[model samples]
Target: MPKLDLGLPSYDSLFSTEEERQESKLEKIVSIPIDKISDFKNHPFHVTMDEDMLKLIDSIKENGILIPALVRPKDDGTYEMISGHRRKFAMSHIGLKEMTVIVRELDDDQATILMVDSNIQRENIYPSERGYAYKMRLEAMKHQGKTIDDFENDIPVEYNKTTSAQVGRKPETADVLGNQLGVSRNQIRRFIRLTYLIEPLQEMVDGRHESEIKIAFNPAVELSFLTTDEQYDLADAIVANDRTPSLAQCQEFKRLSHDGELTTEFIQETLEKEKPNQKEKLSFKMSEIDQYFPKDFTPNRKKDLIIHLLENWARKKSREQER
Candidate 1:
């Protein structure tokens, strides 16, 4: 064999060895321009500019995004952000043009599962957020050929079998998700049901106390079975009357819906019925009552004083009537 002269540069300089290339792929972190990243499709989580977000922005500004975002490269030369939406938003708010991201090769189902799992670890997830997240993850899991029973224990097999029969199907992927999330399977199903709610009603569930009408989770779950049009009708009834459905009223709505008799008029009539909580609750401005109570008085002390005053007034009225 004669020695041959090759004009190519050294292999190490020209291209990485297979092992080195594999190592580089595993070490996927890279700096990508913020504008080059698009949000995950149908991202169920809400990215709000609330107190937590503000704190995150402060931390990132001081610490320079200590954790890198997880993203997937797209065919369009952009990256799809699978997680760290809040971090991205914070970076953008602080005028950062580029962000550190870890790019992973993931299919849609894998990305969805990862997105849900990553965000579900947050402490402030809303009911609606959990609802949509669970639904997405459940679908993804099923698409990946995982079954609900695969995650369930043997103890619940008989019980699940009975319930599954009633529902005319196997225990859904929500059951598997529930096992992972430490929620009861029934509760997981309820949360997934909330995903069917109209946006207004869903927002009511998300913004419960802050919204004009407070919707309890149980009642909201019951209302979720109503058709889209019926849900809109219920929402209108709620806003118009400034009242949310009681559990019993929600049951009535569900019954009507199941019978295919639910209508806007029925929703109004059902909502118009007085609920126990609908009793006129008297509220006084804090400024109006603050003058009568000692400056140092606690709310309990103020309440005691108000009760004593009411008792005295009742006694005086009784005495006047006796005379």
Candidate 2:
């Protein structure tokens, strides 16, 4: 018996001409004029003409771009770069007029996820790059109603059930993103917080400015809470005093700022004081050393044990040196 044709057509057949369906099925990769590609809007990663770029240029000269860049078409007859800012940059530097790209039709959020995953795993990503990239991708994931489960293939799957077990509740957006990026929850929080920093202070965090000392990462995060004018005041004081605030000093600054007690003169006075590195004492956070101790050990007991072990190790090292 013939099956009754339900007066219904397949959605594809109903919506499209045969040519449009065929075009959708065709291969997406194509060579296009380099000028037709635009850099990703608000791209976070930097493409410096440094040793890395020189190395990349050399690699392309020898083998060509082994991987096609990913791009998305725009209404303006141009393409927005998604995953190959560095490659595009290298080809441009090499004076190549046309390049290979795989054109993907993705919305903003999906494109952001693809773009971030492409660059975040590179060996040389700076803190600022990771900061902004993680922020962008995390927001994109949340916007798309995604979770850590959706990101398995984009990153190495390292979600160990026994070791990485969460307590109390389901993971939040930042926690999900941190796991995807292999960043710890607390550390990822700090990195995302860096996006709130002003441009000059952010550059100081990157430690690339010739005129100023590199602000320590924790101290910089502490400073991100200050009002804009307060931050400028702090920056001027840092330059005038030839010193960056220590983490402790920045913590104090944060406290004062919250209490409406911070001022330009006070900031100068703080940075002008002796830096924490000049002090004789060394400090360690519990998180850094907790793995070496048993769960029941108290802080004082741990400190005593550490000192005893260090003394024995030093004496043994001295005897080895004499021998």
Candidate 3:
């Protein structure tokens, strides 16, 4: 038999063979029954869907779920969901035993990597979710009997360029975390730090009031010296209303709570500040300022008023500058 040579490029250089392109297209399109889905607590995408879960349940009652969820096949002949936990919970609410899911086969590491990738792209991931997810992945790797520190150090130094600034000296935890997640060492440390937060405050952290949370964090740490009720009060003060309580207010809350100086009257007063009369604040506007002037005020009178205001403002400004 004669071997014939065809003048063709190597198979590796081909961007996509006809069959490969077809398979890619098919993979892009999927619809599965929702029933086969099960949540993987170990999945990196496992964010607490408590608030959304309730809302999803209500929505399913009116409008059926419009989006399919993602899942991976388990060796036990079940499917583990990589995402769409809220949809899964809502389906359960509607008494549907199964749900539509697109399936992929992934090992523990691959599943976690995919899970985090799917979730972080969402517009509204809570801080708690981000912090929690990062921590979970860190612990998961640790549980695999692999030291994260070694894994991180083995990764090329070039890979650390973006995230190394945030990370300080690599704790063993930091090494594993940074290496596995391909994140900066600093980011890994920050996420791990959040685990120190108590549950109620952690809930607030997940609520994504970052500015409020940032402001509340130190105060909360200090206020944690007080009992649970006091912490709740501090959170209420920070979250419910926009009042930037003086440092004195926080210290006083701490001192009184500790010294047994806290009383119903004191608590009531603090809460009163938190619940300032919103209605009263909204009652007046620029239009109301018009009422203070005459109904048909002359332009000359307006000019006169402006001159008088300028004179008063200049005096105030001069006094401030002198001081």
Mind giving the per-residue lDDT tens digits that candidate 1 earns over 197-234? Answer: 89899889877435556688999988887888999888
| Candidate 1, residue 46: how far the Cα is off, in Å | 0.9
Q: Provide the overall lDDT of each model, using Cα atoms, as 2-decimal numbers.
A: 0.84, 0.84, 0.60
Q: Put the candidates in TM-score order, highest first.
A: 1, 2, 3
Give the TM-score (vs. native) of candidate 2: 0.74
Cα TM-score per model: 0.78, 0.74, 0.46
lDDT of 3: 0.60
Query: Which 10 successive residues of model 3 have the least lDDT summed?
Result: 150-159
Give stretches of model 3 more than 4 Å off.
1-32, 42-68, 86-100, 143-146, 149-184, 208-323
How does residue 255 of candidate 3 score in lDDT? 78
Candidate 3 residue-wise lDDT, 85-130, digit = tens = 7687777667886665666656786677567766765667655566
- Candidate 2 local lDDT, 48-77, one digit each (tens): 998999999999999999999999988898
Candidate 2 lDDT score at position 187 = 71
Collision pairs in model 2: none
